[model samples]
Target: MIELTLIGIGTGNPDHITMQAARAMNAANLILIPRKGEAKSDLVDLRRDICAQVLAATVRIVEFDMPVRDAGGDYAQGVQAWHDAIAAVWREEIARHLPAGGKLALLVWGDPSLYDSTLRIAERLPGVKVSVVAGITSIQALTAAHAIPLNPLAGSVVITTGRRLRAHGWPPGADTVVVMLDGGCAFEALDPAGVSIWWGAYLGMEHQALESGPLARMAPLIAGRRARLRARHGWIMDVYLMRKEPSNG
Candidate 1:
């Protein structure tokens, strides 16, 4: 049986890795890191840096090209196909590295339970014993970086992706919304008059940038900043939170 450990390493910060994640990395016989191409080289670099800091010299590190989902295809279908392709790649790499089953680890960005698909891909490996080591999530970093609570006192928050927020509109009864995986500034689609936004890019990193204000005033600034950062870095990962005016309470 293959012992598959999915360790969340947080956004791009090495220190965000938990002790559990470090232990898992040190214990793994093989650790697979996916190359997201030159546009997102920082992601792979972060993975490599984590391995360098946490893994023992005896542990083998492998890099594999990640499959990109086709934007022209149905969104769900494209994602499913991409996941299958990734699973095949994982199986091939695992077989090549460890003909006999052994402990393996994959470093995940942010918590697997959030928006990441590492856990889903692991399920495709039948009989694989899956273990998860949670780390600081982007949501946590975004909220903490902004020095704001996730929700109003005695209230609740809804966590979602940029696509859902843009396509389905704000969820009914949601007073606070945390948006992630947004390649575009989906906040532009919302009615900004009464909304407040807290946005952060490269959270927890040295180059981190944060901006928050009334959505009407901050939307354009966040949009411009995001574009500029993406141009400078070749790619970017960001998240934001929106809340109704506190006076509405």
Candidate 2:
């Protein structure tokens, strides 16, 4: 039987790694890192840095080329094909490195339970036992960076992606929403009135950037800042939390 561990290391912060995650990393017979090309090379570097900081020098680390999804095709079909390619790569790598079947681990950027699809991909593997080691998510990092709670007193919060927010608008019955994977700053389309926005880029990293104010006021500022940061670093990961005034009955 093969044991597969998906360890979440959090948003590019070495210190974000929990003791349990560290143990999982060391316990694994092998670790795999995905190389995401030149633009996002820093992401692979961060994983390497985390391993170097915690893993014993004797631990094995391997790098593999990540599959790129074809963006020109239908979105849903493109994603399905991409996931299939990734699973094929994983199967090949595991067979080459752990032919006898032993424990293997992959360090994930954020907690697997969130919007991430690593857990889904792992399901493609046959007869493999999977375990997850939770780590900080960008939502937690953003809220902590801004010193705010995710939800109002006894209130609920909605979590959605930029695409969904653009297509569906504000979620029903949601007073607070945390938006992730927003490439085009979808908040600009929103009615900013009565909405306060707190935004952060590169959360928990050395070059983190944050902006907050009335959505109307900070929308453009954030868009511009986000562009500049992306130009400088060649990549950016950001998330924002917006809360509208609660209705008074």
TM-scores of the candidates in the order shown: 0.97, 0.98
lDDT of 2 at 133: 97
lDDT of each: 0.90, 0.93
Please state the error at residue 141 of candidate 2 in Å: 0.5
lDDT of 2 by residue, 157-176 (tens): 99999999998899999989
Off by over 4 Å in 2: none
- What C-alpha RMSD separates each model from the true structure? 1.2, 0.9
Local error of candidate 2 at residue 111 (angstroms): 0.4
Model 2, position 38: C-alpha lDDT score = 98
Residue pairs in candidate 2 whose N, alpha carbon or C atoms collide under 3 angstroms: none
On residues 115-232, what C-alpha lDDT tens digit does candidate 1 reach at each position? Answer: 8999998889997899999988999999899889998988779999999999998888888999999988899999887899999999988899999999999999899999999999
